[model samples]
Target: MPGFLLHLGATVMCSHGGQATPTAPFARVTVSGQPVTTLAAPYVIAGCGMPPPPAGNGPCVTGQWLVGATRVFAGGLPVLLQSSTSICVPTGTPMQVVVTQLRVSGV
Candidate 1:
């Protein structure tokens, strides 16, 4: 079986409250992994909002994910952006996951 890789790189911004201004977009990501046949098709790239953790993690880090048309072969995925999610970082609050990378294999 041939192995495949996908590289996802992106910049994300987050807002905490409705008062403070949003912070600059950061970088978060995932590396290469197994590939899936389903993902090879030309599917609409959509942002799968941050999923809830096992337990309530206080609204979780406020970030956003965008979709694009790219090939996930056997390498890395780089996702870049200017304004992701919202613009407004609340004071005394911390943002999480500005950017990220995902890898899919086994096609």
Candidate 2:
């Protein structure tokens, strides 16, 4: 499937609603005036309110992209896409790509 490339400015969040930001962006490529992200980078999560302790699994702290554009490469790394799948650490929840550049896409 084809999807828009994910950039630093893209709106991504954990399943629990924590905002996710890529620790590293591929500076070699730009989308919507922002650096594109790759699978090599982990996302830092913030503002998650899942719960705590025995009551629940609690907030997600980080996320790692498990899927990306199979044919798109940035600096020899697979570029992240809007349809890319990710999993949050500890919580083992998936992240959601809410908004991203609508112009550039990859499969």
Candidate 3:
């Protein structure tokens, strides 16, 4: 599917409400002056509301992108899009892309 490209400034959050940030933004690609994200890097999460073990499997710490733009490549890696799918580690929850660069779209 075609969707807005995910940039460093994109608002991405885990299912538990933890904010997800790309550990390494692909500097070779830029969207609206911000570096674009790719499947090559993982995302670190913070401020997760999920409780610890014995209560709930939560507090997502990191994320890995399982899907990305099939046709758009940055540094030989697929660029992440708003429609990309990701999995948060330990929590087994998906990361949600709430906001991304509207100016750029990729499949």
Candidate 2 C-alpha RMSD relative to the actual structure? 0.7
Cα lDDT of model 2 by residue, 1-107, tens digit: 58999999999999888999999999889998999999999999999988878978868999999988899999999999888899998899999999888999999
State the local distance difference test value for candidate 1.
Answer: 0.27
Q: Whole-model lDDT, candidate 2?
A: 0.92
On TM-score, who's better, 1 or 3? 3
lDDT of 1 by residue, 1-107 (tens): 22322223322223322111122211232343312211222212123233335542223333323332243222243222122112111122322334334433332
TM-score of 1: 0.20
Writing each residue's lDDT as its tens digit, candidate 3 over 15-99 gives: 9888999999999789999999999899999999999899988779999999999999999999998988889989899999988
Residue 79 of model 2, lDDT score: 96
**Model 3 CA lDDT for position 2:** 88
Model 2 residue 27 lDDT score: 88
Better of 1 and 2 by TM-score: 2
Query: Relative to the true structure, how large is the alpha-carbon lDDT of every model?
Result: 0.27, 0.92, 0.92
Residue 35, candidate 2: alpha-carbon lDDT: 97
